[model samples]
Target: MGSLFLTACGNLNSSSTSSTTTTTQSSSSGYQTTGQSSDSEYQSVIQNGSYLTSKARGVGITQNSENMLNLKAFESGLTTLSKTEFSPKDYIFREGQLLSKSTVQKWLSRKSSSNPTGLNPKDNGETDADKRNPIYVQQIEEQDYMKEENGKLVLAGITIGIGMNRKDYYQKEEYGATYTTTISKAKMIAEGKKAAAEVLKRVRKLKGASDIPIMICMFEQAPNDSLVGGTFYAYNVSKSSTLGTWKSTNLQSSVLPTTSESTAINDNDESSFTSFKNKIQNFFPNLAGVTATTKYKNKSLQELHVKITTQFYSETEIRSFTQYVAQAAKTYLPSGIPIDITIKGSDGDIQAFIARESDSSSYYTHVFDD
Candidate 1:
């Protein structure tokens, strides 16, 4: 493919809708890959307006099943950074097709007598938890970007996410008592970069992907019990086999209402969330709860994801409540940043969705019926 730079500006005003048909392919490693048809077409999740995702999803779980928050943040957080380099307007989004489940499984394994390609430190005989070499790499994720050439979509760029463990949890035997080993931030970054460098080299060798501009990010995974996900601390883009100087991402994730003593959040944003939460709950006292997860880049709010749980079952009541929520979101929430609010009933079914794009004055709303 030629240079990804384009003279035509991409439309980022609001979400656009597209339709897709599903098809499944089995990787050589035996993992079933479900995605759109062979047309290389894109499909949006209906709620997310930013980019169209590949009809075929990537074939693997990149995060621990217990820590789902990190999985969501890991993929979406990388997307936010990827957008800075690869604009969704110019590139169609697809899950990491280059890395398969079996390939990732080998890479994530600890280097030992059997698994030499493993990215983690080799196992040395040691009973002391403090002296043992911990598992630095937890999982790896890939995102591919394609650009049109000769009226066909071709691979133009790739983004790789390296998820490292802040705390390594393990069990010597099946169903045995679990043990934990803490990894320092310094050690984590060093190992993560080393693994990323190796990953770049391997990806460069993948079929016909050589010389493609690749961006690799280093993420610190949160503990299994953390309420909020971890953050990406550094990233670098490589156009060749050798990686370049790393740059700090300054990306962070936090829960709304500012509950952390160490996390420094925008006072205005916190106050706005508090007011919005209070206003709706005060009006509808039977609400189960109201909460949110926020993303910040360079300490500025970039995205807000809100979830409101209620007990109301009537469509009439849900529609009325959605209207009130939308009004409150516009009047009180921070402006010029994308905000997504989802209201659900006690049964956990989505009742309505409200969203606002960045720099847009007005918001959009939708109420679903049974």
Candidate 2:
């Protein structure tokens, strides 16, 4: 991974002396800093300059049947929640390293006579549709936090994300039409909590994970037809095998230029996005389309990501258009919030990237050379 930072914009800092330098701060856990990878990788956690990724990366993609939006949001949202307890300054971030792909696959399966370790409801031969067991747990994700002790990195904490299905689709016979089982929010939460408890019990048995604090988050996945992904609704951290009181999160995702009346969209934010879209498109008439996927917390915008498609092919045109986009973003979009914009050609290759960090007025721009 060539400098793991998000490629929305290539590294814009030209005066950097060393590429290996990482953020240094006093650790509350009293562990001295060692080394970390470059901070650009969006998926990997970086703290105290140490960058270790999951032994099993992208496993969630194959395991979970949800759309890519849901998969990405599920993991990233869990990391945001994990930070309240596992501070980046204190703990080194690692992806899902503890739970192997096979382990998670087993946990996602339905409980049966042979598969005794399955976490889902037991398979029963019932003819009635009402009596059938719905597959509550769809996918599971694990993230590990480590700290240096005795000149060695040890497991400090763990966070597990349990993705629950809102609609379970199945086929009764071979090459048959699929049937949908809709799970109510109340029923989903109850099953999610039960799965959390059982997951905690098994995770505690792993080596070196006996006493470390573990955070478990429950995610409600969107329906199949939804363009936006799901959100983590509740989470709880446990010091041992026993879980504690659950806390709820208000994190949610919405597509820009609202399409649904059920989803409450902020008028100001929507209008700002509309303005930004109009400005960029007006600058270049050859543009194909502009869209955004936004994430909010407690009804406040937290992150805005835009994707622009264009028919222009010239590198000079791409760079010039990116500059206009950056200016339009600053003038019309919401200030003091993280914003990322990517310009792509009709072929789907990224042409340029522009990003604005939270609370920063400047925008970083990069146009990829062919």
- Candidate that would win on lDDT: 2
| Runs of candidate 1 exceeding 4 Å displacement | 1-62, 260-264
Question: Between which residue pairs do clashes occur in model 1?
Answer: 35-55, 35-56, 36-55, 36-56
**Superposed Cα deviation of residue 348, candidate 2 (Å):** 1.1
lDDT of 1 at 259: 64
Worst 10 residues of 1 by lDDT: 25-34
What TM-score does model 2 achieve against the real structure? 0.83
* Deviating ranges (above 4 Å) for candidate 2: 1-58, 126-131, 260-264
**Clashes, model 2:** 7
Q: Write the per-residue lDDT of candidate 1 for residues 114-218, one digit (tens) a residue.
A: 888899888786645687788899878888876655433457889998899989987666798878899989989889889999999998998647988999999
> Each candidate's lDDT (Cα)?
0.76, 0.77
- Looking at model 2, residue 249 earns an lDDT score of 88
Per-residue accuracy of model 2 over 1-370 as CA lDDT, tens digit each: 1012211222324523212222232322222222333342222343344544566666778755647777877887887888888876566666766687777877889888887889888877652456778888988999887665443456788899999988887777778877887888999999999999999998898877898899999999877767778899999999967998899888778887677564546889988988888887866657558888888888899999998998775788888898988998989999999999999988898999999989689999998987
